[model samples]
Target: MDSPEITEAMDALRRRLVPGTRTILGIAGTPGSGKSTFATWIQQQFGPGTAVVVPMDGFHLGNAVIEGTPLRRRKGAIDTFDAGGYLSLLRRLVRRDEPVVYAPEFRRTLDEPVAASIAVPADIPLVITEGNYLLADQEPWKEVRAQLDEVWFVDTPQELRLHRLVARHVSFGMDPAAAVAWAAGPDEANALLIQATRPAADRIIPWEQELE
Candidate 1:
């Protein structure tokens, strides 16, 4: 499960660590591109007490807030997130002054973000965050990128990504037909947007190799 991309990233992160400061690494990719998996792998490689993961999905707006709006249909779109709040969390994580910082977690089974579900202790030196919009060029997202020490783009095949998205939705209780439709529609749109930000990444990791 090792690759030159990951090895290089690990070396880079280790070099960036200082006694009192924490380094933040971002993993960005299209939906179903395995950003979360990759981030977790990186954290595991770094070992316990040295690294932690904080996902951007936790910033997703609650269904209640989106239910009466057009965003309900486009649930995963950029506008459906609390970009400003996410930015605030990143800033707080950068401070590294608190005993422990609690971050929210998104539960796919409940389709909601649970408050203070993940804890980042001050002593942990590496923070790995993964999401679709980490490299986005949009307003608050542009600011979001500034908080990270380095950002890696997860490159995955479109066919595999789409297939994964369909399976993911189905696993979460969505109808097969609706899952396929969403994968082709809103998911594809968001994927394209994510793809556009690939050039901004510090590195591109081919996800297929990691999958194997």
Candidate 2:
């Protein structure tokens, strides 16, 4: 689907959600693949009433915790996140008995993920958790897939994703060279791992493709 069409399809998804389902719609993609924009669009179409988004990025372990790890520099790596905490949040969010569930949101400007930035209220249905490793086969991550009612894998051409990632890194204050290096290096590696999990998703998607 083209951009216009995709937006309509997502809005349609939001309309179909009945209040208080505790349902999760997982959207997974490599960095710079536009998953966030797509997700934000879906939320906007819901018009501030239903279907609030609670991103998994909100569960990133603090820099303090990651600073001690071997994978410290590659903060975006799957291992750097608070996988267990994320699991717990998903469990709570998926519970049918809950009147409301609070979740976090990642703040890019501060480089800190805020806790409890969003709430999945009893009346609003459909929680969207978009991230890199929701369907990963690795430990901790594997369990997340089970909470999702459906998983949508967002695909983009490698070159396009790479270009966008590098630009974003630079915009975020990384030097041009450093941005390109990380995007082509660790970022690409993570992308490869994410690619392997595509088949596990309920739906495989390319941005702008129609949802059928």
Candidate 3:
């Protein structure tokens, strides 16, 4: 997780890629560990080759499913997402066929996710697929890691992650106290689960730079 090792991992991942690779980079980190931010940063750094990001959040079940199922209590739990759909897209994404492929995007404002938000043309050399459960040992999640060419796990301090999570929830309209409670309760519990997968990552990034 040191700086040198982190850069080396990134460099090695870059070296394996060339034009027409359609490389799938998997990034998993606990909620508030900055998975989306880091993925966006990497995409921006990837230059103009159409490197797109397909977040696992896009596969979250609709409101009805969440409300009616046990997942309603733990909205961001490991089992809350539609792992099958995510696997399906990943399987298709790794294919070497021609034509464009559209990936889904999660709409946080509506608290509902949608499929096929981005049209990923076949020419793109890299696709960043990030989420908290990519390395999860659960049935389908364990297999999810296999589809990725390179997988990096983001490791953030527990205290900082809690702070970020609380702030994030508050920004989304929750009261400050409620945000902290949720972050420390369900959110922190999820972070513990994600940290258990750290040893499985090809690279671990502590993310000490330019993050609040």
Top candidate when judged by lDDT against the true structure: 1
TM-score of each: 0.95, 0.88, 0.93
- Candidates sorted on lDDT, descending: 1, 3, 2
Judge candidate 3 against the unseen true structure and give its global Cα lDDT, from 0 to 1: 0.82
How does candidate 1 score on lDDT?
0.89
Query: Model 1 over residues 1-212: C-alpha lDDT tens digits?
Result: 66798788778778898877788999999998988888887877765699999999999999989998999999999999999999999999998778899999999989999999999998998899999999888799999999998999998888888888898899899999999999999999999898999999999998863331
Clashes of each: 0, 3, 1
| Candidates 1 and 3 compared by lDDT, better number | 1
Candidate 2 error regions (>4 Å): 1-16, 208-212
Cα misplacement distance, residue 51 of candidate 3 (Å): 1.2
Candidate 2: 10-residue stretch with minimal lDDT = 203-212
Better of 1 and 3 by TM-score: 1
Q: Write the per-residue lDDT of candidate 2 for residues 90-165, one digit (tens) a residue.
A: 8887774677777888888888888878877766677788999999987788788888887888887777788888
Tens-digit lDDT track of model 3 for 1-212: 23786678778868877765768999899888889888887887667866888899988878888897778868888888899999988888899474878878888777888777977777888899999888888798878998998789988777777778888788788999999889988887888898898888888887743353
